[model samples]
Target: MKSLQLLLGLSRGQHGVSQSLAIDGVWGATSSNALASFRQGMGIAEQGLLAPADVTLDALRAGLPDGVPAALLWAVMINGSAARIEAFHQPLLAALERYGIDTPLRIAHFLAQVAHESGCLRYTEEIANGQAYEGRKDLGNLQPGDGVRFKGRGLIQLTGRANYRAYGQHCQRDFEADDPAQVSHEPALAVDVAGWFWWRNGLNEWADQDDLRQVTRRINGGYNGLDDRAFYLARARWLLRG
Candidate 1:
């Protein structure tokens, strides 16, 4: 109990006098606040005591997606912390579901691909400054700086001007025509954009068939990180279906 509290950053050590004054295994107010706060955070009742199942320690420790215990999301983001994971868990699920990634298999596949592409959501835009894509006519970079201007954004890195314009039209809103940087600025939009890309590209069918190579090719436009995508797919499959 003490270890858990400490790990969760609910510590009384800052108050040297109060820290040492424990009436037993408990530290009075510190213990009370920590326990209560954790309970609420996990969506459990505010009651002081809860059974193991009710509290969902296993589900949480396993990093289960909220409301859908049957589906487990990958928590091992390369650059994601516990706070980061918790913040986007429910919202990610919602966006995925809204974009036709409703099945456990589809959901897991979507999460894995996004995780790999965004480097676990730590990066929403490409890191290479769009220099390599300069003058790439196929990407609709006709202008001098269209490459940097239309650089990839969102979890799936929606690169290329043509792609942005098309996706925006598909959603019946102006992203590329109006503001191409909105996805970079808004976190929620970044998530939804990724879901939209998946839904639009028909990747769900490949996920259903467990054809990871095809899914990777579609998302990445080639076999850039086939092994890593495969690894994430396997992990997501276990977490969601196992």
Candidate 2:
């Protein structure tokens, strides 16, 4: 299948294979050799055939390019949906690149916070009703329904009318006035907003310092879910290590 071939091709360098396998969805000798090489590297039996239920597919999914592997994401967020993982793959990568989360430490810290905030990319918008934030002048919910209209959305849960307006202004998208829900509806926007928040708050500096507590404080304004955030941070660091 094309998926297997693509994984194998992406993994060639890591597995000590030089030949490129055509990702044409064909089962051929070249593909077989590549798979065998990958299997040998993984300490698995060098079976030429690609089995439907083989663990090799999972291993190959973690191969290279090394931003945030889907396999590692799945591992860290054990309850994450595979469909969501697949959908947010490219968007998350792009957001990280755009926001200068280029190193393993930065990516790990960023992902740890977002993972804790978004429940491992499961819920983009906050589950609770926005009534609690009603009439909260600090959050710029001055109007009758500004709270519900601009409830927290995105991976980092961009909340409040002021925050939305700020992000909309930066991106030239009027999310505060029109289409506020689009932040949660679009994967790219959801992830990008997190990147925007990270960049604006200079959390990457704290991340670079390896100060998990400061990073949490910067994003969360407190130590809420500090334990869970630390758990994800450790997992990401281990998985993202080169």
Candidate 3:
């Protein structure tokens, strides 16, 4: 029943219609009306049955574009700028494909984290000054200004001098030595760093198991802003699922 509601919601979203069902596992007038509307839109005969046929469900799933759609990205990042959405769209898709975040579940998890960490794609760098990290050897903030120099950047907020050096090495760019700020400045690099972190942490395995808590812990090093993360996760799942 929830699956039906999700499909209906997806159909509505794809058509630029903002109406959405609650996706609860209960049959009600709203669900009936949504189903009827969907059938009408698809040029199918409307039926009074609460449960739709397998063929109808298959039809609904058919032709869903591979990877996340821009409409869905806008939906998930509700407060995000349209220009930013346009800017990140192709870069995000490329990163997803390159990192093998191709499955619906993986995409959901990845987008949810990105949405939260980036504040719906608004922030590329951490807002706070990096003074607290001045002597944090764990992050390899080994120099006098290492903390302020490599605080956090990129979509997933990659932090620390060590991390910058390592990711720079991976990309063959001197992020640490030359300019660490480029991680957030370059759209493709901003998204790619997140993909690299995802792959490095083996997050796909946890996403495959649908373990949101574990994924959050891995990404955040704890459960900060956990509810917001879950909210985005639910939204991404609804938007991405067939």
What TM-score, computed on C-alpha atoms, does each candidate reach? 0.67, 0.75, 0.77
Tens-place lDDT per residue, model 2, 122-197, is 9889998888888989989898988888899999989889989999999999985588999999999999999999
Error of 1 at 40 (Å): 25
What candidate 1 gets wrong by more than 4 Å, as runs, is 1-79, 177-179
lDDT of each: 0.67, 0.82, 0.82
TM-score for candidate 3, please give it: 0.77
lDDT of 1 at 5: 35
Each prediction's number of clashing residue pairs: 0, 0, 0
Q: What TM-score, to 2 decimals, does candidate 2 have?
A: 0.75
* Residue-level lDDT for 151 in candidate 1: 88
lDDT of 3 by residue, 164-211 (tens): 989988889997668888888989999999999999999999999999
Misplaced by over 4 Å in model 3 are 1-39, 43-64
Q: List the residue pairs that clash in candidate 3.
A: none
